[model samples]
Target: MSPTTVAVRAGFRRGAIELRNTFTNAQDLWGYLFPTLILVVTIFFMRGSTVPGTDFSLGARTLPSALGMGLAFGGLIALAQQLVVEREDGTLLRAKATPNGMLGYLVGKLTLMSTTALASMLIQLVPSLFLVDGLRLTSAGAWLTLLWVAVLGLVATLPLGAVIGSLIESARNLGLVMLPMMGLIALSGIFYPINGYPGWLQAVAQVFPIYWLGLGMRSALLPDALAAVELGGSWRHLETLGVLGSWAVLGLVLAPVVLRRMARRESGSRVAARRERAMRQVF
Candidate 1:
């Protein structure tokens, strides 16, 4: 087999092993489920509320929007977090030493994170059926849209996450990533309709993947009539595809260059220096 094929297989194996390990670990199990449980309760409470202009449960609408946000969060934050933490501990240096190591490492991470995000969405969605009304979960179209949007969201955001991870010198700087993301999330209309915001704010929110992710998701799971509440009174699948595809293209072009630069700078000495600084910050 070619080196690239071997590396891809190795990466898949690595991701599978890590996922199984996480499933078996008690702490990891709890860590994964706890946030999901909290979101469930949050959704349960929103059942009383209704989507504007229609009688559909707001909670149900929130569910898909939240799912899209989950994709964004997983693609951006989780991958970036792993990169910084692993870099601090010399994992990146080790990977740099091996043939096709970076390729394998990235593939493994994407595998791990994409599965985790899908699992989280299913976990939340299944229970939410009991609490929310007007979801089109029964329809095949819903699942298909969910599938493609999730895939596109991953493609759009993960490479950007890699670029961010490559740029930051320390894990502590993840907050810089978090703050802007949170602001975007707020403006993205995960809990509310983006149409409620001013036109300029609406335009600004549309520029990021979060809004498009939410929009794609809402299109997938919400009712057809609810589209009236959206910006153009339709799902705008074409626009969602265009915007997300553009981001995907941009990130794909930039990630390799940034990651290559970051990997070139990695060394034993740098790892040691970073570890020392991390220890200082901790203690």
Candidate 2:
């Protein structure tokens, strides 16, 4: 087969393997389940409040936002850590030896991450409709925005995760990568409105993609929130599209460059030495 054809087949096979492996593994189950647990807990706590100034329970707004956060955390942090672990275990090296290996391997990883994100989002949506009030979908446009935001949010974040996974030296050090990202999620209005945040804080939040993802989601699901922003002289729809697009472009450009450099440094002997050190520490 031609190199391109071989790569495509390899990517499909690898992605399927990875997806199955994730489902079978207890650790991977927890990777998704833990965030979901947190979501459930947050919903339980917030069940008493109605949607701001409405008969709708707070769960409507809160659950959907939590679901979005779950998708982000799963696609971004969980997938990134898996990549780091796989790299450490020499899976990446083995893949590298194949035709167009890196491309195929990345395709697989992205595929798996996207699937997981979609599943997580759907699971969150059920509770959103039944438990939350004023949680009605008023128009087709809102549904379209939600769908795109979730999909694009995954697209925008996953490449950056891959870049980080490639750069980090060890799985143990994954926290060094994930912590800052989680912090950004917290600051990005995932749990609350950006309006509640101070002006400077909102400005800082705007630097990251999660902020826009959360904003876009809110716009789709909460029309009043969008209208409020319009009254404040902010074009939230334009801003959301622009910010998300910018991050997607930036990640697409930067992630490959970073991955290539890191792959070069991760030669066999270096990886072996690192694994040996890690084993010694474990023992």
Candidate 3:
């Protein structure tokens, strides 16, 4: 087999091992279960409230929106955190030393992250069916839309995470990304509707993938009449595709160049230096 093919197979095996590990490890399972619990609780509180301008359950609307937000968070923040932590601990350097190792490393990481994201989504979504009402999942169209939006959301966000991970020198600086991400989430209409926001704010929110992801998810799960509450009184599926696809293109083009540079910079001295800094912080 070719080097690429061998690397791909090895990566697939590694991802499978990692996925099993996630289930067996106590902390990892908690990581999957805890957020879902919180979401359930939050939605429970929202059950008494209705969506603005309509009698529909706000909690139900929030469920799909939150799922979209979680997808983006997984692709962006979670992936970036993994890279930074692994790089700090010398995983990236070890991969760099092997033939076709970087390719295998990336492939494995992508598989692991993608599967983890999907698992988390399912965990949150399945129980939510019981908690929330009025979801339009009886049709095949709803599911197809959900699947495509999720895949595209991952495509748009994962490479951007890789790029960020490559650029940041330390995991301690992840707040630089996290704080901004939280701000974006607020603007993205995850917990509430963005239609009521000022025009410029709505415009700003729409520029990022989070807003589009949430919008897409809402479009798939919410009633068609709910579109009246969205901007332009429509689902705007074309714009969702356009914005997310643009991000995917930009990230796909840029991530490899940045990751290559990051790999090139890795050495024993750099890893040791990071360890020393971490020790200093602890002391």
Candidate 4:
């Protein structure tokens, strides 16, 4: 087999091992379960409340939106955090030294990210079905929409995460990303409608993937009539596709260049320096 093909196969195997480890490794499993639990509890409380104008369950609406947000979190923040932490710990340096190791590592991360996102969605969704009413995953159309939205969401966010991860010098500086991400989450209409926000704010929110991801998920899982509460009184699937696709394209174009540059800079000396800095921080 060609080197490229070998790299791909190794990547798949590494991803599978990582996925299994996520469950069997106690710390990793807690990292996986805690967020799902928090989202579930948040939705459970929201179930008793109805939408602003309509009698529909707000919790049900929030469920899919939260899933979308979770997807974004998985692709962006989670992936970035992994890269930063691993990079500091010399994983990237180790990969850089091996033949086609970076390729395998990248593939493994993609696999881990998408699988974990789906697991999280299912974990949140199954319990949500019992807690919240009016989620419609029964139809083929709904499932298809969900699939496409999720695929697009990951595409749009992961490469961007890679770029961000490449840029961030230290894992400690992750707060810079986290604060902004929290602001985006608040603006993206995950738990509430964005229709009431200022026109300019709505315009700004629509430009980002987080809003579109949440909108796409809501479109997939919620009933058509629920669209009334959404901006323009519709799901705006075309816009969602356009915006997310644009981001995906931009990220794809940038990630490899950035990652390559970052990898080129990685060396034993740099890794040692990073470790020293981290140790200093602890001491």
The number of the candidate with the highest lDDT is 3
In terms of TM-score, which candidate is stronger, 1 or 4? 4
Residue range 140-225, candidate 2, lDDT tens digits: 98899888888888878888788777777888898797678778877876766566678888788888877777666666776464
What's model 3's TM-score? 0.98
Tell me the lDDT of candidate 2.
0.74
lDDT of each: 0.89, 0.74, 0.93, 0.91
Q: Which ten residues in a row have the lowest lDDT in candidate 3?
A: 100-109
Error at 247, model 3, angstroms? 0.8
lDDT of 3 by residue, 1-283 (tens): 8999999899998888989998899999999999999999999999999889999999998999999999999999998998999999999999999998988988898899999998999999999899988899998999999999999999999999899888888989999999999999999889889888999999899999999999999999999999888888999999999999999999999998999999999999999999999999999
Q: Which candidate, 3 or 4, has the higher lDDT?
A: 3
Ranking by lDDT: 3, 4, 1, 2
| Cα misplacement distance, residue 282 of candidate 1 (Å) | 2.8
What is candidate 4's CA lDDT for residue 280?
Answer: 89
Model 1: residues with Cα > 4 Å off, grouped in runs: none
Q: Write the per-residue lDDT of candidate 4 for residues 1-283, one digit (tens) a residue.
A: 8998999898999999999988788898787688878877887777789999999988888888888999999999888999999999999999888899998999999898889888888877777687777778789999999999999999999999999999999999999999999999999998899888999888888889999999999999999999999999999999999999999999999999999999999998988998998888899
- Candidate 2 displacement at residue 258 in angstroms: 1.5
Task: Name the 10 consecutive residues with the lowest summed lDDT in model 1.
Answer: 28-37
lDDT of 1 by residue, 1-35 (tens): 99999999989998998889877899977866876
Candidate 3 C-alpha error for residue 123, in Å: 0.3
User: Which scores better on TM-score, 1 or 3?
Assistant: 3
lDDT of 2 at 1: 73
